[model samples]
Target: MDVLSDVMTVLRTGRPFAARFAKSGPWSDHRIGRPNGFGVQLMVRGTAVAVTEGGETYKLGPGDALLVPHGAAHLVADSPDTPPGPRCEPGHAFPGAVLRSDDPEATHVILCLAYELAPNRNHPLIATLPDFVHIPADPGERPGLAGAIAMLDGELASEQRGGDTLVPALLDAVLMYLLRALLGPRTVECRFAGWATALADKAVGPALEAIHAAPARQWTVASLGEVAGLSRSAFAKRFTELVGQPPLAYLTSWRLTMAARLLADTEAPLASIARQVGYGSEFAFAAAFKRDFGTPPGQFRKQAPACDPGAEPFRREAVAV
Candidate 1:
């Protein structure tokens, strides 16, 4: 699997939630507090003003997107002076709530998304992201993000036959595009130096792919360096510089992350999971898991919520503004 896909597979928990809203006139501002997860706001039409927790304000126009990666409290309003109203409840649906204005031309449409990430297993890629990321709606600037927003807007606007199945997939695609837009070519030379840069490097990228592809392999610095077509010392230094950790350190973390997923999602035996994540024996794996997670694997499995096979893999709900 690709790096982003692999990271998301390990870090994402329950199904993501999303919604679209149609607002007209001068409405009371909405303050959203996501707590442990992240929230996304996209302006599909018209314009709005966004204020971060630190009082930073942004004017978001059509096609613009905002990501609250740290789950901070934020306000979205028709104008910067609009006072925030009551907190919106999760899963609340408002089809077409009338605001302060009845003018059809004053309507401001928005798409909102929420994601629940694994709190315990924070990946380097995610850790490297800032508290908030804003992507302006420039059609020719970042075509991927613009295209995703366009597709999502169309899908949400129309009542299609397979929309129930299609929208969730499209939301996931939009998320991928958003991340790509944030960590674009400009980030390679400055700012981001961890997983973002590592994934962009031709040499380090292949080595990371190899490790993620086969966590069970008995990998060494020399072996990984060979995969990157570099000498051991050079590869080690480069990997450390870009990935923000030694290769072995990252490998161990990845193995444990995979083990955590298997524990939560499957009934695989502890010994089996250990082997899958490259541990030689159950005892060793248990010790390592305890050290990393501060809980035994069995206990962790027992405490984790069971994955529902019959439920939708991705759930989305839209609220009217």
Candidate 2:
């Protein structure tokens, strides 16, 4: 998989999130889509039938996580053995409804929620993983996941906090935990290994940290090599092998990424934004921004929609650059 060069951080618009419970009696079928945005669904308890984007079907169980990456449509049901019957009418007080099941006597509750994922280009993790990520239960580490389920159950079962305020928060936390279990080790190692991660090399931590800490600073092969404690020539060779680009080239690209974020979010003056991002003047910043993004900063922001207040800007600095 090319050892993956980026990560994805979802941006939220400060919109309140919600979750609901569906009562299923023997026969129940439902469809889910990304009407609001991307989200993760944790099957806290019981087994459900899942049909993914490509029409592949699988039985999802407790502790399993369904990560809908690109807002593709999916179907989750109590049974795949039979077609669906009458759906519970809308405005039924809950997010889901009950249908007749094969058992005719067995009853189950399916928990669901709609959430927003922050957007960022620097991280490519979201596109790398499967549309649905299923996490297996760890008998020893059940407390955390189980507690998340409990919170969801309570939020849906009771009318506390004026609505289901806690379910989304709980689900988001649960997804983070699941991700930690799946990618935690790699992320930790990558941090110590440094920008070589982005460059696909090793022993580049100091350089990565320095670049991230001060994207606007003027940097060169000699200065970065000094930070890496290597001679300029040796550093240049090793850096190219890992980062896939010359030092000055990488620095320029990084600076442009920062400028993009500032333009997209803040209403800062052009000169000020340029200065903040290390450009010597407004003209220099605009030239670079135009070259990188295909338009000037002012024009880019004008064409773009108002960003989510809660969303972190699209700058590389906001992510692990």
Candidate topping TM-score: 1
**Backbone N/Cα/C clashes per model:** 1, 12
TM-score of each: 0.88, 0.63
Cα deviation at 182, candidate 2, in Å, is 2.9
TM-score of 1: 0.88
Backbone clashes in model 1, listed as residue pairs: 19-318
Model 1 lDDT tens row, 177-202: 87777777444543466888888788
- How much lDDT does each candidate structure score? 0.77, 0.54
Off by over 4 Å in 1: 89-106, 158-160, 185-191, 306-310, 313-321
**Candidate 1: deviation at residue 87, Å?**
1.2
User: Model 2 off-target regions past 4 Å?
Assistant: 1-17, 25-37, 82-122, 142-149, 156-159, 162-172, 187-213, 219-261, 306-321
Candidate 2 per-residue lDDT, tens place, 1-321, comes to 112111212233233234443445354445445533455555545677767657787776765666555555666666776565433221123222211112222344455444444333332334444566555667476567666766665555544553333444565556556555555434343322223243323344467667767777888889998988889998888776556667777677666765665666679899998888789988888888888778888888776433332342111111000
Give me the displacement of residue 196 in model 2, in angstroms: 12
